[model samples]
Target: MRARAGGIAALVLGAVIWSAAPVSAAPAEGVQRTTIGAAERATALRFWTDARLRSARDLDAPPAASTPPAASAAGGRQAAPGTGEEVRVAPLPAPGAAAAAPALAASDPTPWTGGGLISTTAGKVFFQNAGGGTFACSATVANADNKSLVLTAGHCVVDAGTGEVYRNWVFIPGYANGDRPHGTFTASSLFHLDQYVATAGNANYDLAFARLAPLDGRSLGDTVGAQGIAFNAATGREVHSFGYGGSAAEGNGERLNHCSGVEYPDAGREGSTMWGIDCVQTGGSSGGAFLADFDAGSGGGYLVGDISVSAGSSEYHPVLGNEALDLYRQAGAA
Candidate 1:
């Protein structure tokens, strides 16, 4: 699925849910994880795609008294997207109101993994003139080379409304109470589905990857360590997904929540994911990094996906599919 460059894709109105995807597997270097049974592959992949999308890391502001016509009228429907193939969208939930998720654990406010949100869409829509129109969200630090890179939802940085990109776009890994442990960085380049850049309508297709250029002359990773990224793997495998969102499980406003379990697939090509655990949450929690923290006994986390679409007790993430990895490799990140 390609972002429509300053345009949003056709939306099919319904309940809001969540999402991410990656393709191409580098040779499995770490301990090889077992794959899910082939019999369950079709079923698992089915629901993974058709999940609704929402924002992450912020409190669910009061529901809009009225939804905009453009947001309410999801009239676009096109052919299915490709996976492990060309860029394509998968079948997932419709975007919009679903239900207030159950309470979650209040997460740690201090960022242990050095991650934060990528966009401020939550700030843009819910609060006008807030943060100087500069919004705050969350994301996590990851390293492929010796550079500092972050993983987040596509819409966080890419403003579908204006072709112009984020102005104060910067990263503060290990942020706590506005405390930047790694310092600030302007995004050098952001990578997402061509679908997202083209259309703001596809939240399920929402995802953003980037290379950070330091603003304070402090290089990333040099300032703060980076999390390992897991590629070359299969679904239904056990992993951990952590983020700083509001909840009992995580905490409110500056907190972190980590959930772990096996991953399942979705229906459409976007290649959706259903977390094995339950973390009831609301808006302001999108773009959270999903890490598969299987330490070779080190007890650290390896990032695999980002929070894109979610709803109810369920959260939809984009598993690091094979196709997405190809994009990273093409960009020289992987």
Candidate 2:
């Protein structure tokens, strides 16, 4: 259930519910998976032409004037103590020194001009909803054993309400204007937590991961360096979130923008325990990375959470706990 500030509608379109394709096997407990094979990947690549990619709508774009629904309470039991350990992975060496720019003000959505690994690792995600509506969001490559794992919001991968995953999913790293610097990578598999699936997008479990197929005999991490990821990390720290959010002022999703601020607990209409930052990023920003200890020069940091929802000037993200850690491990192994 990804939403934008200023009365935008949620990403899920309830008018036409659809079903997902058959999975390879039963998913592990508390997890859901959808596999994309070679044939499907080829079809997806053909479907997303340059024109169609440019015309795709932002998932968080404002719809007809109407009041959005209230967010449901966070459901599901808490993870047991010691269930998740703090983990970190160093990023691969990348060119470029840190940029000399002023710290972006809180709640300010500014275009990212610093050229670093982030320019290649964080990119736009395009897919069609279960109802065949073309839409776009944001995602980031994360360091993993397989070197092909991508992290995003759960709703960006599947509709929690219908349990139907999107179609023609593709990630274009270093996407800018209309250029794809690195080749597009298709999703080989998608993973989500059971709580988000069962509860219809509970914000507490809104995180998801994608296992991507290699491009031109190269893995995503090998092509574009990945950001280090962390689970069960301490909160209340400064965070830098990047995404290709659409807005008249931000090139309508053609360029990457970011927001930076200290994180706090969400206390707005969502009524969930997700973390919040003073950011004005809109709908397409969902599934963007919330990085901790980000270095402006190297454009690398530890992925702590992902964009989930936005209310007015504040944006929210799920707390990456044991369940999120488990999902990452599973995706990496896949």
**Highest TM-score scorer:** 2
Worst 10 residues of 1 by lDDT: 119-128
lDDT of 1 by residue, 1-334 (tens): 1111112232212122211111212222211111222232333223222111022124222111112234336543432223353322211111221322222232222323322221111111111111223334556666555355666765565444332233334555544444443444555555555544344435544555655665456556555545566654445666555555544434453545555555665443232333323333333455666656344223235666666554334455665655356545443342
Candidate 2 global lDDT: 0.78
Q: Give the residue spans of candidate 1 off by over 4 A.
A: 1-132, 161-164, 215-218, 247-250, 266-277, 296-299, 330-334
For model 2, residues 1-334, the per-residue Cα lDDT tens digits are 2344557545455547554464634367777788898998998999999999988988763221111132222343443212357777767544343443444554677898876777788998999876678989899999999999889988788776677788789999889997988889999998888777665556677788999999999988888888899888888989999988888777788998888998998766433667878776876887888999888767788898888777767887888888787788889999
lDDT of each: 0.42, 0.78
Candidate achieving the largest lDDT = 2
Score residue 262 of candidate 1 by CA lDDT.
57
- TM-score of each model, in listed order: 0.57, 0.88
Global Cα RMSD, each model: 15.9, 4.1
Off by over 4 Å in 2: 1-6, 12-20, 24-26, 61-83, 94-106, 269-271
Model 1, global lDDT: 0.42
